[model samples]
Target: MLIEQILKTKGGDVTIIKADHTLAEAARILDEARIGAVVAMNGDQLAGVLSERDILRQVARHGAYALQMTVENSMTRGVITATPQETIDQCLGRMTDRRIRHLPVLRDGRLAGIISIGDLVKWKIEEHKAEADAMAEYIKGG
Candidate 1:
């Protein structure tokens, strides 16, 4: 399956935050959105990504005061991106190698959507089940 198909099912809504937004604000957005990460934007440009792991790391190093720092301070820079044309299995390999859970999907050099490891795993499992069911039906018919 292609990344585009996953996005079609997951929808194209990306929860974005400004680079200047405080960790406190970022936390609120994460909690309210019930998402693990958000794309950090700088005047319509992709800055980086802020994840629960990023927030926890900052808090571990700087204490509660880290909450006052900007998202740019804690966000992971040089983010690895995925194109709509990428295959699900191929993405799984890259994500595993990089130890990243989130990937920003780009189309035409612009942010299109964001996908998480959970999403890929879920879809992969579904694909496997569908394939197995098809094979079983073929056997029964034969």
Candidate 2:
């Protein structure tokens, strides 16, 4: 399936946090949203992405002081992004190759949405179940 199709089902609302926001603030947003990451924005521009992993790394490296660090300092920059037109397989390949779990979707250099590995995996599972059911029905009819 295409990313656009996934977005249609998942909605395109992206949770955003300012680059200057503290890690503690980012963590709060993530917990409240029940999301693993948030898009870090800089005055309407996409600056980076701050993920749970990123925050954990900071805490590991800096102890409790990491919570005071700005999101920009803990975020993953030069982010790997996806377009709405891309296919699930293509995105899976990219994510697997990069060893990343989330992808920010962009349209005309603007953030449109974001997808997690969980989303892709869920779609895949649903697709397989549908196919299996179809095959079983076909065999019964035959």
Candidate 3:
């Protein structure tokens, strides 16, 4: 299925954090939202992505003082993005190759949605289960 279809099922609400926001603020948002990441926006432009991984890395490297740093300081800048037309397999491949979990979906220079590896895995598992059920039904009918 295409990313657009996944967005339709998952809802297209995009959570964002200002580039100037502190890591502490971003962490609060993530914790409150129960989400792994948030899009870092510089005005209307997509500046980067700030994820839990980034926060963990900062803490590990710089101790608790890292929390005072701005999101732009720890965020993954020049983030890789996907288009709505891209298939799940394509997105999976990109995520695997980049060793990243989240992907921001862009269409016509606008932020469209976001997808995570968990979402793709869920879709794949559901598809596999349906196929197996269909095969079992075919065997019983024959």
The C-alpha stretches of model 1 lying farther than 4 A from their native spots are: none
Question: Model 3: residues >4 Å from true position, as ranges?
Answer: none
Better of 1 and 2 by TM-score: 1
Model 2 residue 67 CA deviation in Å: 0.6
RMSD of 3: 1.0
Per-residue lDDT over 23-55 for candidate 2, one digit per residue giving the tens place of the 0 to 100 score: 999999999999999999999788999999999
Least accurate 10 contiguous residues by lDDT in model 3: 5-14
Worst 10 residues of 2 by lDDT: 41-50
Please identify model 2 stretches exceeding 4 Å from their true place: none
Q: By the lDDT metric, which is better: model 2 or model 3? A: 2
Each candidate: what lDDT?
0.95, 0.96, 0.95
Tens-place lDDT per residue, model 3, 19-77, is 99999999999999999999999887999999999999999999999999999999999
Q: Give the TM-score of candidate 2.
A: 0.97
Whose lDDT is greatest here?
2
